[model samples]
Target: MTDSALAPIDALLRTHIAEYPGFPTPGVLFRDITPLLRDAAALRTVIQHWKTLIPEGIEYIVGTEARGFVLGAPLAYEIGAGFIPVRKAGKLPGNPAGLSYDLEYGSARIEIPENSLPAGARTLVVDDLLATGGTAAATLELVRRFDVEVLGATFLIELAGLAGRDQLPGVPLTAVWTIQD
Candidate 1:
């Protein structure tokens, strides 16, 4: 579906997202997006909405490992751009540049191959959610190490009170849905 035709995207997100309170920890409410992924209409709306947020002329779409991979690949195909996967520590086959950061519950690392993209390639980063912004910031740093310009970062949803966007100053970020604390 065309980007403009995705006006119902917000409703689709609300319908399919599952809320799990105290998940992975006490006092933490996790907004699970797996339900949205399972629903064909919600999934399509998410991709289309995010595609609309991406500015034109992006050469590469970089997605963090795991969940990012699922969203980024289709977005890359839809926008006719190249896809680059930023994987976890030691998961990448080649010598990769890695960045370490703290998540809400624990610390984690993300890696990207040194040669994933040519120098100065424009890249758009995609992820399933934006919580504390640690992962997103690390991914951005990893992309910068390759000398690629980060066009923007896109997410299916954002937890507003977490202030994730503060960590990504000067980088464009777009979310189809946001949960206010």
Candidate 2:
């Protein structure tokens, strides 16, 4: 990504990403991106950064549930890729392929639409944040069930020092903003 792309976006993120201490539990600092999402230019810069990182021939963009849906759908559209959803179990209509996994806080499951892609289709997995890699790993496994090759996993933010990337071995992961703990 260009220095022009990184500077402005990182500045906006540093300024607007809210920190909630003792969230979901004590000793936790939650970096909320709601303000970044609300800023059109910052949001655009985020996608623009992804545009530079995303390799060509990505047939589909697979987004993790909740926040990923916010960024992934738009990124897929901007990059001319089909959007595939990876959601929380029981949240999807009809039967889907699901995988249960552990998160930094607790256990959770993620599911993808059955037969979403043909074998070997290049897909990029996306989410808003990577905290412990549980959800991202689960989503990656679910996506592989469809026999597609996951090009990479991308995130809007990465909580450094958590080592979430350890859970996702052999997979390329990119995060636009990184906060060291």
Candidate 3:
């Protein structure tokens, strides 16, 4: 949970990041991570960093849609836990539980396959970034619907100034690198 253990992966993130001002809207600085996703070393570093931060008794890694599946799948593999996809509404093939919430720029809904995780299963939520806590909070709500215990939540990088953590009150949240903006 400390920055000390996160140092090894900092260089990789910095190398692959790009920032754009006023993206998707005015007065918004968009941080793109496609560069990191395209690099083997950077991806490996992300999985490695997450492997060490997983909370004890975590039986599953619940990844938020899109980017979360990108890194969370691999991290779950390395950590010997199962990966549960919390995808966008209508993306999954079966009956799924859904949650709607606001985004940094818009509103959206997310879902998880019904009965994907057993009742009381301990889980850790992972994602590439933490900008607004809405997605993560919604994911946690989905987890609760399945009756899973959230061991903790982890992110590769956190946009710290957004107060994303405040929305997910009482959860043990950790990010490898936090950018205050």
Candidate 4:
């Protein structure tokens, strides 16, 4: 859907996110989606809207560790696609392919289980938030290791002030809501 078409859902989503000032660190504002997840109506609305945003024929949804799992899994089920979980280092069992990257706040590593997808499967990377795009970019890199076709990426919210999109060139990115932070 176009930005204008998604305005209603985006407006409703804004109300679902809780804002915290100076959380997890000083001088950092946190937008929490716990409230969104707790509300059945809101969650359903988001999932339905995402269905329209996601491309047709996506073979799998690659969710980033943690929040992405919450959103991606259901969306995958809704769209009849498989779900792949990308995790932080050491979180995956067995021999997983790993990649290290820098975050806006610090540095971290992400990993995906090796041979998780059949070669040439198409996928969409998903997460709850897009900040500096470090994690998303790293997750995309990890997804590439599987020799799959990355269709695009989607997020629940985007901190536009951070310009995370710049970190992900040549990839179609969609966010349910965008706010300056």
Candidate 4 to truth, TM: 0.95
TM-score of 1: 0.92
The best candidate in terms of TM-score: 4
Better of 1 and 4 by TM-score: 4
Query: What lDDT tens digits, residue by residue, belong to model 3 across residues 96-145?
Result: 88988898889999988887999989899998888878888888887888
Q: Where is the poorest 10-residue window by lDDT in model 3? A: 1-10
Q: What tens digits encode model 2's per-residue C-alpha lDDT throughout 1-181? A: 6768578768878987899999988887887879888988878877877777777889899988788898999899999999988888898778888899887777898887777888999999989889888888888888888888888999988987889899999998888887777
**Estimated TM-score for each candidate:** 0.92, 0.93, 0.92, 0.95
lDDT for 48 in candidate 4 is: 91
Top candidate by lDDT: 4
Model 2 residue 154 CA deviation (Å) reads 0.7
Evaluation by lDDT, superior candidate among 1 and 4 = 4
Q: Model 3 — TM-score against the truth?
A: 0.92
Off by over 4 Å in 1: 1-7
Q: How many Å off is the CA of 59 in candidate 1? A: 1.1
Estimate every model's Cα lDDT from 0 to 1.
0.86, 0.85, 0.85, 0.90
